[model samples]
Target chain A: MVAHATPKSNESKPIAALLVAAAVAIVGILIVVPLVSVFYEAFSRGVGGWWAALADDPDTRHAIWLSLTVAPVAVAINTVFGVAAAWLVARFRFPGRSLLISLFDVPFSVSPVVAGLALVLIFGRQGLLGPTLAWLDWKVIFSWPGLVLATTFVTLPLVVRELIPVMEAIGPEEEMAAVSLGASGWQVFTRVTLPNIRWALLHGIVLANARAMGEFGAVYVVSGHIAGATDTMPLRVEKLFQEYRQPASMAVASVLAGLALVTLVAKFVIERRLEAESRDLEAARGLENTRLEATRP
Target chain B: MSIHVRSISKSFGSFQALDDVSLDVAAGTLLALLGPSGSGKTTLLRIIAGLEFPDAGSIEEDGEDITERHARQREVGFVFQHYALFRHMSVFENVAFGLRVRKVPSAEVTTRVEELLRLVRLEGLGGRKPSQLSGGQRQRVALARALAIRPKILLLDEPFGALDAKVRVELRQWLRRLHDEIGMTSVFVTHDQEEAFELADEVVVMNHGKIEQQGTPDEVFDRPSTPFVMDFLGNVNVYHGRVENGRAFWHGIPIDYPAYPHAQSREARVYLRPHELEISPPGAVANRLGTSLAASIVRVTRSGPITRVACRPHGSEQELHVDVPTETARGLQITLEPGTHVAITPRNARVFIPGPEYSI
Candidate 1:
């Protein structure tokens, strides 16, 4: 007789084992090996040798500094815009509201390199708005502003898209209760809405930050590969690899790779919270739709 | 605080949720907006609580117009149908939220929340999160949080609609007692007529975005001003018949019609509740020829206090429902079983002229 089947009844022992082993083998070859080798090759010439490769090149240090500053600025701008946009679209109904939400997703569909090009068209020396910037004596394209703008454009959809469903699922009943209990609008958001959406907001921020830091296609277009000035970490990695400095390239690439690993871990924890939030949403929706909207015959 | 809603009308796009609905809640009275779904009871309660603005009406508290004021400025306490407790905060923090926002001192906030927690009878469970509590417990926490502000009016939107039946009954009694003690001008929405009758000092019956009637429970029940009110209050058995010459006839069985003294003969309907008719042994109504109808018992069920008997009269396609006391059914000393013949006699039936088309 077969043993009692679990809820996972589709499972078969040999097939499961084979599939798992095949998956592990594929991951080991395609992903695990490459990820491990990045660090292994980084310290191949020893830690001090890797340090000299990084310290010896002021351009690499400056590139590291550029990524550090650009990602935060991009993430900060996205965080505020995302929450505001999500709050606006989620809580209110206006003309063109859904169209606006779709427009926010344009960044995802459009290539990051294409977005960088669009930024160049609008802010570059020979681009539209170039005359206004020139009159104001401000440099945008081939400068820090262009890099920040490109990075911000590439990560725009993360926060708003993440927040809209969660906020809509949570509903406005709690905020209404707070307001009815004598809480101001500002207090309702700060003490109630923000805390409820904190995990989801953090989840979106981590994703945006990861994309902002590791973005190469967009940052490379605007940075101009200027040594010690505009070249970011990803652009610098491309430069070193082009010059045949493989060890130093791996060393700088390792830093971004390590950050990606941290973002993944942070995402793992936040995802657990978000999963619980969705379950709560199911229960809350049941209460709302079944009872609150229940009317007579 | 007494709330007065004056000629309120609201529409959700094409659906008219509330239409010129007006009602008044006396000070310290517990009023219930009772209706079926889409009856606009919840909409009226929300409007009174200042959570919703009417398209063409004003809300007044003791004769002062507060229509344009926001919910926070109105100082009303609202309990949502689903106990919308802050999932992230502890029960203590939720109760202290309104107090903290009002800039109450930290010590007073603690004292007030503790006192209110005791009032709601959740004294020591304040440290637990709302998710950890039972549905009834969460409901009480929502109440405690709402009451922390000492609001002028207390508005509950189907407070027990989401709870299980037993908890609903328990909370109903508890809420009644709470209202008596607080003496606040409180209003609640419910579709259960029994709930409205039992809990409210005055009941406002609504249907299709309009008020059908509003009165004390007995006044509304005993003397329904409209046929809609009568039909909505309880189950009524209908018999298609004709009314003429100060009498209504069902298959030539004459019934008294004192209220309608029309000389003209016209078709009508006789509405009788299950208890309004009497059941007799097979041959007991031989002398009562014109007053009784011959029928066979289809089924008899003793559900709770009443025994329900399903009967099918001869030459009638419609089945009739008859309710008797369980004790009375046992005392009849006759074949109350299925297929057993009996004589059904009407004690008195209310007569109403049929509409353009026949209706049940």
Candidate 2:
């Protein structure tokens, strides 16, 4: 029998080879080289210099502390909001449902600086709710809360966008089945719906965390960049660079860069696990066929 | 338990899904809701299971009104068309889900799950995930999970619609046997006529959100009340004809119509099942009572034990289809030639006057 060339095998064509090489070259020049240079510049004076630059600088320490405190709180809030929003949007119908879903993606489409400025326009001392805020003695812009608010706005769509498709694809059948089998509303969610979407939810959280930690443009606009107070990690790196502290700047930048690499690896690992799960499911189906064939007389 | 649904009316947007429909199911009897798509059979089943509430109706179970009860409080088992098994859990856990949610002890859950698995013939296969099983196995697992709760009534929506043909037949027979073994009051919705006929003692024929007829399978097969029920039941040949003097006549062939004996010649339709027709050589049978039509053979197909013959009548453009046993075809010397003359006689045919407009 003559063998037909499958699409996977066709990837060995010369055109595919050329395209792959071109992609690798572009990635090396654009992404890999800059990344390597950042780490190289950070460690130029040695590991001891890197450590001292991070520890000896009080403003850098405060910025790091501030970032740790702010992003997680935003993530936690968005986690709750993500599940609720995804469930509402995926499982039910109401007025303006499509409009509300598209509205959730506003942060993604609007510029980060624009979102930050919009927040400032709303809650800043002279903006829409400025009187209410000032009367209540509440500080929003140029404070830790402003940082949290800006970070949350930037990462709002990540968790929700990830979960909506998964939940919608699952549909209401399993929940219906669960309820008909005598499960309460909460039991249907935790026992049936949550398990079905847990991987996607976790995947969303990971992406949200990465975006939360790395958000800069919006934070730069809202934080006011006060040293040892409102300045976050990205803002601190920029401050160090402007003060001619190149190696120290690169040191702090490398930490952020390292966190990004860690997130990349984590994302890659999670995606691989997800693929493995679906592949195992398909493989099980294929195994059933082969087992049936083997048992046939 | 007996279930009574009264005056159920439901609408989705402008589509009237169920319009003032009422029905009753006897206790310990298997009933099949038979219909095509948009017939509201599945909707009625969901209302009974409390997954959906009727727009204006009340549902009663065992003489108690439960229309306002939530699905979680209904204690009814529903198996979805797609088997809706919890994909992340093992088969054992999927079956044990209902018991566990009710806080049944772990030991009892294990024993009950094992028993249900064995009943479904999946005793050793309980360790696998739902995705790890074949379509038939997955459906059986779903049945086990639904049966795990031991609810008052069981509802299934096209349970075997996903399986291959051979497996579907096997599952159908097995499901009937299981129904007999358990004898729980069950109602299943199906569009497959054979499945409905073979599985249910009582069959309810539905069309356009209304119950056309409800009776035993034999009663419905023998006496379908409406044209929709007759057409939906199986493949039938329809002829444009007329009824006069208590007889239905098509091409000078008088069909038996004892029910319509009025001396009125009006436009009517005659429905004849393919298997109910007998095809033979012309002038062979004594043509008494005008029960025969003269036709030429168009084509004959032999498949297994059945032979399907297509014949077109002389001096007419219409064609008649007849199904005969292969042995009987040989006995009658039925041929596949397109121009050979033959006679086709319907053993029994239905006659109905067409309304102003008949929507299939």
Candidate 3:
């Protein structure tokens, strides 16, 4: 006897087509149009205009360098913290686990400006840790350090949020199995847990990197918008727009947009690869089950 | 090596998973912890493997206390119910994991892993990932991986629970032979009574986080020490009544019952296996076994070699199942059909004074 009664699939083709059309139209307006428009406007003043905005404009050059420098640092710091946090939250049970997980979501929930404000409240000149930091001759409020700090705060949850679900789904059974097989704690994590989570970790890192590179409000509040020192790619785009350098603004915007596109593509590829790997694993298990059933007496 | 588990008690929040459970495994003996889900058999196995810690009690391996040791330090090989083989690793790498983790020589790891792959009868398939192997094959790989460490004790938690029935039986036989050859002190947890009885030299039956009985297969089957054991092992008819003057009265009829030290309790429960009860004509007196009750056949079912007759005692709502050889039913002159009255005599029955533990 069949266990489940099959659901009818007599959906109207016209309605399905209408739904697909609606979705495509929405994506076209929101994503495709803006993406095409950025490149269109960037090259409106010709290739020299684009190159002049990027290379000739020293502030924009500094902004590019600043973004490049800060994003990697933020991504690197968050990557280590993300894996550790995911491991702690997913593999072990403890009091306040939900609270810790919720705290990770704070960056996602709260406004980016509020996150920057919170950081400033703690690290600004007259802020809580400011006096002691100043005693150590540390100027954090309008420096590269503040920009990195704000970027790190804003992008902190990206990798961690990506990792938690994957780690939790992977479960503790494999780790326990490793431990039972005489693997030490470190060995178990390195050999078993790390391999299982590596793909998800990479995906998380990509997302975190993308966010760190594009972060604006948090970095803006902490950066003080120092022309050649603290201005990031997004801040530079805003500055160029205010100066009526439309092509330069669009040019910097286009670069950020291009990076965003690359991030999206990388994210898509990683997710697809993960999906394919899981599907292959599942199909292999199904085949194995069939073979075992065939060989059964 | 022999292992001793002493008064292990573990509680998870408000629920007690194990309550003062103790067991011993003789050297090179195969033991089964048999219980239904939530009965702490798996918990006990985990505790013994050092994968879980008991809130109270001590565990010793070959007379050495190892309760405080980490699972890695305990040197116990554990096979999970789902065959927790490393999915990313090939069967060879999976088997070599333990040795590699211990930093065993590369040549020895390869030789030992090959030997184990052959032992588990998956020699040529070692290069395949765990996902590429059948459930039975994966289970064997898990076993081989556990054995690679040459552990003193091997623990398996429902090792064949995930496989189909046919494969389960095949793996059970293979595991029996494997255990005999390896001669490791193995303790396996399973809820399947048949698997426990067939695979282990000793079986510990657990219920509600406590051991109900522990004995040889025949001993536990033929003489269950508790009502839970009797019911858990096989189909049994239970008769609840009042006991007085060394006899238990069911439906106002006096029945023979084995006296218990706690017979002072007015309430009693009698357990008789289906095969232990014999069916004859209403007034027929066969061999003098025990009390006979006049019952009307409620239903008769013939399946394969056995004919089961379900009958209700006169004026009693409880139904008793009696199984007889189909040939015996054929030889009888009377037709065993519904509505035909028969005398059901209990060849043996266990009488327990009613208590909370005796309730199903």
Measured against the true structure, the TM-scores of the candidates, in listed sequence, are: 0.91, 0.92, 0.92
- Candidate 3 lDDT over B1-360, as tens digits, reads 999999999999999999999888899999999988999999999999888999999998889999999998888899997777887899999999999998999999999999999999999998998877777788899999999999888899988877877888998999999889888899999888889999999999998889999899999998888888888997888887777667776555466665643447487887778898887887663432446777899999999999999988877787889999999888876799999988887777787776765566
Ranked candidates (DockQ, high to low): 1, 3, 2
lDDT of 1 by residue, B1-360 (tens): 988888999998889999998888889999988888899988888888888888998899999999998887888888998888888889999899888889999999999999999999999999998877877888999999988888878989888877777777898999999988987899999888889999999988888899989999999887666566677888888777888878998756888877668888887787777987889886865664668888899999888889899999877878888888888888996958899999898776777785553244
Per-structure clash totals for the candidates: 4, 0, 0
The DockQ score of candidate 2 comes to 0.43
* List of clashing residue pairs for candidate 2: none
Docking class of 3: medium
Give the worst 10-residue stretch by lDDT in candidate 2 chain B: B284-293
TM-score, chain A only, candidate 2, equals 0.88
Off by over 4 Å in 1: A1-18, A93-95, A277-297, B242-267, B281-284, B287-292, B333-335, B353-360
Among the numbered candidates, top DockQ falls to 1
- Model 3 preserves the real interface contacts to a fraction of 0.68
The digit string of per-residue lDDT tens for model 3 on A1-297 reads 232433433445567678899999999999999899999999998988888879998889999999999999999999899999999998888999999999998888889999889889999998999989999999888999898899999888988998898878767888999999888889988899888888888999999988898899999899999899999999999998999988999999999999999998999989997887678656755664665455344
> What is the per-candidate TM-score for chain B?
0.92, 0.95, 0.94
- B1-360: candidate 2 lDDT, tens digit per residue: 999999999988789899999999999999999998899999999999988889998999999999999988888888888788888899999999999999999999999999999998999988998887888898899999999989889999988776777988899899889888888899999888888999899999998899999999999999998898889877788988888778888777777777777887787899999999888778864564466778888887788999888888777887788899888887876465678888888788898887653555
On the 0 to 100 scale, the lDDT of residue B33 in model 3 is 95
